[model samples]
Target: MQKIVPNIWFDGTAAEAAEHYARVLPDTSGRVLMRYPEEGLPDFQKALAGQPLTAEIVVGESAEDGGCRIVLINAGPEFAPNESISFMLNFDPSRDPDAAATLEAVWAGLGDGGEVLAELDEYPFSPRYGWIRDRYGVTWQLILTHPDGEPRPFVIPSLLFCGAAQNRAKAAIAAYTSLFDDSGVGMIVDYSTATGAVRADSVMFGDFRLAGQWFTAVDSPEPRDFSFTCGVSLQVNCADQAEIDRCWEALSAVPEAEQCGWCADEFGLSWQIVPEEMGSLMASPEAYGAMLAMKKIVIADFPK
Candidate 1:
């Protein structure tokens, strides 16, 4: 089961963005998971009435297929997705014979009205790879993987620790691994000394697993204008209230960032920790109203 899911906030129409991804990426499809309430919405969200509140896009048919799920949020243009958090798509030749061709197709599709940060060409590390930001301002890194490397999922959420959060990749990964079960650090490659723009003792590339999901973290030697923000958040679905409480206590570092079950960690990354019953609980108008006023979700307070 997927315990942690990546949530992306889009300034444009989320449903359209989901569909765009489905059309571009292979073995992917988009569906509207939840719609905004037709009535009793706040003024800011009034325009989104009867529209998709949350849209989901699954990379593969199932988790057993080594795929992942992503949630696209429907909200105002308050937040913008940046390179600070991006999804890494791996096309392993061992798993698929046409990995190179498929990667090219994905790269071209994502390049539609997208800005290429790294050209799609051979690099020292990979024969074919590229980093780009799509039309919706969401970034993705597509890479053709070597068959001999350790097996991993098709999709991996990556973090670029730059700006104010530079050189904290190790600490951030440690904090997350300690909070979640079945989590541990995988491979970590750090810079030994400062090299021009590169910083000393910074993580060049590090990957870890949290709740069975693969994620990579990179400590940017060079600073950028962006860092972690609410635009890209990780949503954790808990089995019960106890799990939610435990996760909240361990991850919530900013008191002011807590709102409606959402909290920002010390690394400035946003997270939504909620019970699996969240959808059912928020079904009632009363419960929905109560959630708007909550800091940490209390399942007991929800209407039964």
Candidate 2:
């Protein structure tokens, strides 16, 4: 299992989205979809009856070349995807000769019933690039990589600090890298002007590694109607209970946001600090039932 996975929440579209991604993207595969159990709380059971609970999907040629495994949930409409967080797809021609064609095909599929954020065209940074929010409202940034530059992961989760969170991207990056081992800051481009909607010294674009996994972040001073929500969360798989406890103490900031192993950091980003063994334990109904009653997971409570 991947140490870190991006979890997406949808309003009954998780299965559909996962299927579409598997069908359109190269080297992609969708796993079996899971549904809400019939025995859950009456309200939850009635609300989510027979609805898709989770959908797993893998993207990229292989793990060695920066593949990504994402989990999706068909939760209710309590939240929706927004530009606050997006996924960046790096199409390196050096790795794949057909990178351009692949990018265009992907753009077409995702653009259907979607809005374009940036038109696909030659930018100073790359020959082909575009940003779009798919029909499901999830944003994606596609860029044709400079063959001469160092290689990056095929898919990287990106964070956009806007509104009240403006100018906090660098701090968030530093905080995250410090909490996880094998982490460090990467390329950072700071904003030049501090006037109007731009904040000087704020991150214009940057990348960082947390536990060897790459992620991107940017600071946007523009006001928006949306902010971070539980609709999207980052899951950190821990090796042991000690690791989980340490991360829980370090990342958790909102006492009211703690539930079922989920916590909200100071930046308002959600994280799931889970033991790697929890996956196996979930196969047992008894263990699953026990987990539903706790905030910070207790390994001892689950059966071996």
Candidate 1: the clashing residue pairs are: none
Q: Give candidate 2 misplaced runs (Cα > 4 Å).
A: none
Candidates' lDDT values, in order? 0.90, 0.85
TM-score to true structure, per model: 0.97, 0.94
Give the worst 10-residue stretch by lDDT in candidate 1.
Answer: 60-69
**Highest lDDT model number:** 1
Evaluated at residue 227, the lDDT of candidate 2 is 66
Number of backbone collisions per candidate, in order?
0, 0
Top candidate (TM-score): 1
Q: List the residue pairs that clash in candidate 2.
A: none
